[model samples]
Target: MFTFFIALVCIVFFFLFMIGLFLTIKSAFKFFVTKSVTKKQLLSSVIGTFLFLLIFGVTAVPTFGNSSDNTKKVSKKSDGYDFKSIKLGMTQKEVSDKLGKPSSQNDRAITYGNNTLYFADGKLTGGSPKFIQQQVNQKNSNDKQKKADDSNSEKSAAQYFGSKSTQKLADQASYVPRTQISNGNMMYSETISNVKMYRIDDYQTGVTTVYKADESKDDGLGAILYQGKTVTQEKPKTTIVY
Candidate 1:
C-alpha cells in the first residue's frame, strides 16, 4: 500500500510539473514571437507558474515526510505476523508465507509472539481466539477444570500429552494419544498407552475442550473407559509375570 502511494504521488507530481512547465514555456515563446502579447499577460503567466510550484512544494514536503513515518509504523505493526490479514481456513503454508516462520508450531496451532493460529485438518479454524493477544481461549468451565484437577489429585492426566490430530488431546506436547476412547455419558478422551488419557469433549457441558492433559499414573489412571460399554473405575492392576 505504501509503495503504491509513493508511485502514485511521483506519477501525479511529475505529470502536473511537466504540464505547468510546458504551458509556461509556450506562453513565453508566444510573447517573444508575437507583438500582440502584453507585459501583464507575461507577468500573469510567471505568477501562475510560481504559485503552482509553491503549492505543490508545500503539499509534497508534508506528504513525503508523513510517508516515512507511516512506513515505520507499518514495519513495527508487521511484528505480529500481519495478524489483521489472518483469516479462517488458511493453510499452514499460506500463513507461513505471509508471516514467515512462526516462533513455534505444532500440528495443532502455530504461535507468533503472544498470538496463536489454530489449525484442524490442515486448515485454520474460525472463532478460535483473538490474534495478537495472550493465550485466552476460554471454553472450559472453571468448576469443571477445577474438579478435574481435584478428582485426579493435583494434576489432571490430560495435561501431559498434546494431540494435534484430535480436539481432545491437542494441548499437551511431546506425545500423541494412541487412541481416543469414549467413556459413555457423552464424554471422550485420547488414550496414551494403557495408563491415562485426557478429557476431550465433556458431555456434561457440551463444550469443546482444549490443552489439558490428565496426569499419567501407574495406577491405570481413573474412571477412563477405553472403548468399553461402561466407564471403568478400577486403578492400575499389578500382575506377577512368571
Candidate 2:
C-alpha cells in the first residue's frame, strides 16, 4: 500500500515538472517573438518553474524517507524467527516429535543416579550431579513415607479387624500434590530414559520469547535450547538511480 502511494506521488510530480517546463518554454518563445514579454506571462513562467521544483522536492523527500523506513522495518522483521508452540511436561521423545532433533547438547553429571540434560538447537547435552542428587533424595523421602503408611495400615488392619479403618486408610492414601516450581536450574524428569525436555524460543534480534511451561531470561543461552531451525522473512529490495 505504501509503495503504491509513493509511486503515485512520483508520477504526479513528474507530470507537474513536465507542465512547468512547457510553460517556461512557451514564455521564452513569446518573449523572443514579440521582443517584449507580458508581465503576467513572465511571472507565470517563473512561478510555474518554482512550483515544479518545490513540488518535486516535496514529493521526492517523503518518498525516499518512507521507503527507507519501510526498508528498515522489513529488514528487522525478516531478521527474526517465530516460535510456534510448546507443551508442558513434554518428555524427550515428545520434544523430538514436536521439534525434531536439537542442534547441540551439553551434559553435566549430578549425584545419586540423577543428571542434568542441556539441549541447544534441539539436542541433549549433559547436566549437574548435585541437582540430580537432590531430586533423588526428595523422591526417596516420598517413597519412605509411603512405605511407613503401608506398615501402619497393616498394623491397624490386624488390630481393628473391621471396616472401621477403611475410611482412615482412604484418607491416608489420598494425595495432596504440591505445586511444581521452575527455578530454571531444577532438573525435571524425562519420560524417556535419562533425558529431560525443556522448551524455549528466543531470537538474537530480541523480537519474541516463547517458553513451553515457563518463561526465562532472554539470554543467548535460550537460543541453544531451541531444537529446530528458526523461521524468518526476507526484506524487499529497492532500486536506486544514480
Candidate 1 local lDDT, 15-91, one digit each (tens): 76776676677677777888566786677578658756865786788889799898889766655456666666688
- Cα displacement (angstroms), candidate 2, residue 226, comes to 41
Off by over 4 Å in 1: 1-22, 31-37, 80-242
Question: Against the true structure, what is every candidate's RMSD?
Answer: 18.7, 29.0
**Pairing residues by index, what is the TM-score of model 2?**
0.28
TM-score of 1: 0.26
Q: lDDT of each structure?
A: 0.57, 0.46
TM-score per candidate, chains pooled:
0.26, 0.28
Q: In terms of TM-score, which candidate is strongest?
A: 2
Residue lDDT tens for model 2, 1-242:
99999899878878888888788788888888988988988897897778778876886778887997889988656433212222322345554464445444323211112223344444333234333345546667888999798555544432222221223333433341112235322112111122222322233432222222223645312222223333233234688999
Worst 10 residues of 1 by lDDT: 225-234
Best by lDDT: 1
lDDT of 1: 0.57
